[model samples]
Every structure is written in structure tokens, then in C-alpha cells.
Target: MEHVGVEQFPPDKTGDAMTTALLHLENHYWTESEYLAIGETPERIELFDGSLVVTPTPTVGHQYIVSRLVVSLYEVARSAGLHAFAGLGIRLGPGHIRIPDFLITTELNFDDRVNDSDVVKLICEVISPSNASTDTVQKMRHYADAGIPWYLLIDPRSETFHLFRLDGDRYTEHAKAAPGELLELTEPVVATIDPAELLPPR
Candidate 1:
């Protein structure tokens, strides 16, 4: 696969020519070849702010949490006449981003707006120990920068969850879900979930 030109990965920002010139990254010319060069698959991947980030399958506990959360979100959205999908490819841009967890997309008809399923109204991640820090600080900023409306983090270690809502081009802590508690997020979309329901039983 050829690399994408800066214009190809346009964010909400400008300076397309300058952005392309600044990056020595893969050119849109032969993206197929470059993708093969990566030489790894089956691992979860995401293009964050136009950079590739790989995440492997989670632990059994992580999977359990992700599964339950996905099911619940899907059920809720379906009832509301909205759409919720888990582990469906979402285009986060830079490379194909696959969040092994789940996402809630809004479009009645999915489009590759932000990278597959432009309608993604919400995103959720189960933070295993290996990704605690990055999930906390790194992802917090990245999703916000991407202009994602809602971001949820499921932290098993502490048996906690955090929800951030886009506030003025950035994410502000929308809710913190502790064990046995259900946190609510009702903006850019309206939904509520219980972190404990997604946590692995002790």
C-alpha cells in the first residue's frame, strides 16, 4: 500500500501542503507495499492522529469486560433506534484502526468518515495493565484531538472506569465510574453504562 498524502489525512486543521511536507511518512503513492512491510497482523491496530498504534488481544478478563460492555451498549442503542457496534473497523486515520473493544456509531448509514464508520458516536476501551498509562493520558488526548465525541476507558486493575466528553476541541472528564456504579454520558449522544457490569468477577 502506498502512503497517504497529508491532504489525504486532513484533520480539522489546515496547512495541508505544509503538513504533507513536514511528514516523511508513507506516501499515498504506494500504500499497499508499505502495509505489507509492516509484516504483522491479527494484532489490533489503530491510526491515531495519523500515526499507527498496535494493540494485541486482551487478557481473558479484559475480553470478558469488553464483551459485556459491547453487548450492553449494542442493546441500548438498538432500543433507541440508534446503532452500536463492537470491534467493527473504525477509520481513525494514518492506518486502519481496529479497537478490539467496541464503538457506538450514529449514522443511519455507515460511511468511512473518520476511518470506517464515520458515524461512530462513542468509543470504549478496556484498559489492561500493559496499556494503563497510554490509555489514561495518551488516548485521552488523542481521541479528543480526533474530535471524537465520547471516550470510555475500562480499568480493571483499579476496578474503575472513566468517561471523557469532547469539550471545546478537547475532552473533559465527563464521568468516573467506580465499582457497582453506573455512569451517565448524555451529550453528542445519550447513553449510560455500568463499569462493574463490564469488569471481571473477582
Candidate 2:
């Protein structure tokens, strides 16, 4: 993924100084140490080589789905002696990192800046209109390359959910649920998910 420019701000506003600094930082090559040094930020930032992929703050609707999934997955994960996390940074390579909306892992080590990809058992991404391809295409390829066992994609717009299992360097659709249906899974952990419960009360 390439670095799309930073969020723009008006020249006459108080944000001008911060905007100028961010623009200047963009020109420099980013290293893992430098990226880690910046620490937690308001916006979700992923590192790809020397570039940064900045995702804007998620909408309330987007977060609602994530929260619902996390709660549901956490129960299953606990039973299997695993852990579930949301917005956790995962290190794919030396200077490559990606943060899935939600994830299930074998362990939780907060000492590390980001968890290693190998520890991640499953990942979930709730699709947003602005970055649908980033979640569906780019992330799918990268996560599979990293050997993540399972991936779950939830698209609120389409009211659907897709479950995939890594199949030798690629992902093969394992199962899916359409609007108002239940998605059942048996591998990596056994659990059933309802697409309707992911949305806000109507």
C-alpha cells in the first residue's frame, strides 16, 4: 500500500502548523523504529515498507459492528485458551505492519510494540466505503501471505459476512452468511455469528 497524503487542513486555521510538520515527515523514509516511536495515534496507521497507510477514524456504525464481533469472538476465544483483540497492531515484517479491526491470538504480550503475525490465529475487518478494497483485496493478500489461518470480512453495506481460511499462500472462501442469516464456523474455533446482531437496532 502506498502513502496517501495526510489529512488536509485550512492554511489559516490552528492546524496549519501540524499539517506542515506532517507534510514534511511524509517526504522522509519511515523505519520501524521511527514508526514505533510515534506511538499510539488517533487515526489508524499501517506501515508498508517506507510508506504509511493512514485510515481515518472509524464511524460509529463501523465501531458498533467491531464491538459486537469482539464480544462474540471473545467468548469463543476464551474457551479455546486464545485471546481476542480489536485495533491491535500486528507486525508482518521488519517494516511492515497492519492493524486488523479485530483479531484472535494465542497470547497477549503488551511489552512488544506489535504482535508478530505468527501469533495471530484469525483476523476480522469490517468494510467501510472509503477503504473497501483495502480491506477486501490488499489486506486479504497480505494476511494470507503472512500465513494467518482465518479471516472474517463483514460488510455492513451489503449486510453480508465472509469467512476464509488460508489455503497455501492464498485464501479460499470457507463460508459466508447473507443478510439476516447466521454464519457458522468450526475451525480455529467453533462459533456462530449473526449478521443482524452486528447492526444497530432499527
Candidate 3:
């Protein structure tokens, strides 16, 4: 699984020191029920490389970008007969996971997000400067590993949105589309979009 640096909190004895039985989970596979059952502590629990990472609250700029990305993504995807969800967790590996900003599935028969099933056609991340590593590195690796056919990243700092095409277990750089450029995706679904409209004007 790809790893963005894990978020660590100040050590506290109140955590109960509950060590997980992570027996040889190196290839990044996990069940949904097992994932939610772990680490119920108030701290943000993110699954990383077979462990739980306590993440921090994202910054305001990060949130602004996320909100704008959501609106744009929803508009484009829905018009094209796709389904998308925000803040949904996906199993990437044994202990590796991701809760993409938006998850879009184009398969007509795979419309199970409101119920069950883990596979998705595409995953998107709204990137902030703080999440450079995760968006570029960690997510790129895991999304590819998970066989998610399309990956889109919205980077406010770059003033760009990236659309990746999955090739086997890795991604090929499909386009680093400028705000107004439309990216045409060829995958389990087909989507034409301009990411520039996804962000507030610069």
C-alpha cells in the first residue's frame, strides 16, 4: 500500500495500548467490517500499512478545495450517468486504506455504495499543500493497487487537476489538466471534464 506519512498524536496512556493482530498483512487487503471495528478512539483513525494512524483536522484551505471539488465532480459525473460518494473508505491493502473525497462508480450493475460492495470505478482527492505526499504518492500507489480504473486529483497549489489512467498495478499520467481543460477518461466508464471549473477562480 502507498504511504503518506502517518499522523501521530502526542502519546497518552488512555489509549488502552491495544495492539492489533496484524499477522502478515503486507499485500494490502482488508475487509470492511474489520476496518470499522478497529481503533474507535476519538482521534482520527486512518488505516496505513497494516496499522491505524491518528490524523489531524485538515486546514481551512483544504476544506475549501474539497467543497468546490465535490460540487464540480458531482455535476459532471451525474450528468454522465455515474454515481459518486464523499468521504467513503476503501480497502487498499491489509492495513492500507483510503477515504476518497469522492468515489465514482460507472458500472450500472455495481450501484451498491448505499448498501454493500467495495469496488469503485474511480476515486478522487482534493489536494491541499499539506496533503501533497498523500495525494501524489500514497493515493496514487494504493488507488492503482486497488484497481480503481480512474483517479483524479485536484491540487489548489498547482492550479491543476490530474487525471490518471490505471495500467495494471500502476498509473500512467493521463493529464495534468489546467483549470479549464477537459480530461477524457477511458475506463470502466467514460467521462469528459474540465477540472479548472472545479476550483474557485484564481
Best by lDDT: 2
Off by over 4 Å in 1: 1-41, 47-52, 94-100, 108-117, 188-191
Worst 10 residues of 3 by lDDT: 108-117
Local error of candidate 1 at 157, Å?
0.9
Against the true structure, candidate 3 reaches a TM-score of 0.66
- Cα lDDT of model 3 by residue, 1-202, tens digit: 3222222355458863342434344454444444564544443455664544445566666666667656656766677677666666565666565667777765434332222224588788877565679788977887777777878887777777787888888998787777557777665455565666556655
The sequence of per-residue lDDT tens digits that candidate 2 reaches over residues 50-163 is: 888778899899999999888988888999999989999999878999889999999778898698999999899999999999889988999998999999998888888999
| C-alpha lDDT values of all predictions | 0.63, 0.83, 0.63
Q: List runs of model 2 lying over 4 Å from the truth.
A: 1-24
Which clashing pairs does model 2 show? Answer: none
Give the TM-scores of the predictions, in the order they appear. Answer: 0.69, 0.87, 0.66
Sort by TM-score, best first. 2, 1, 3
Q: Which candidate would rank higher by lDDT, 1 or 2?
A: 2
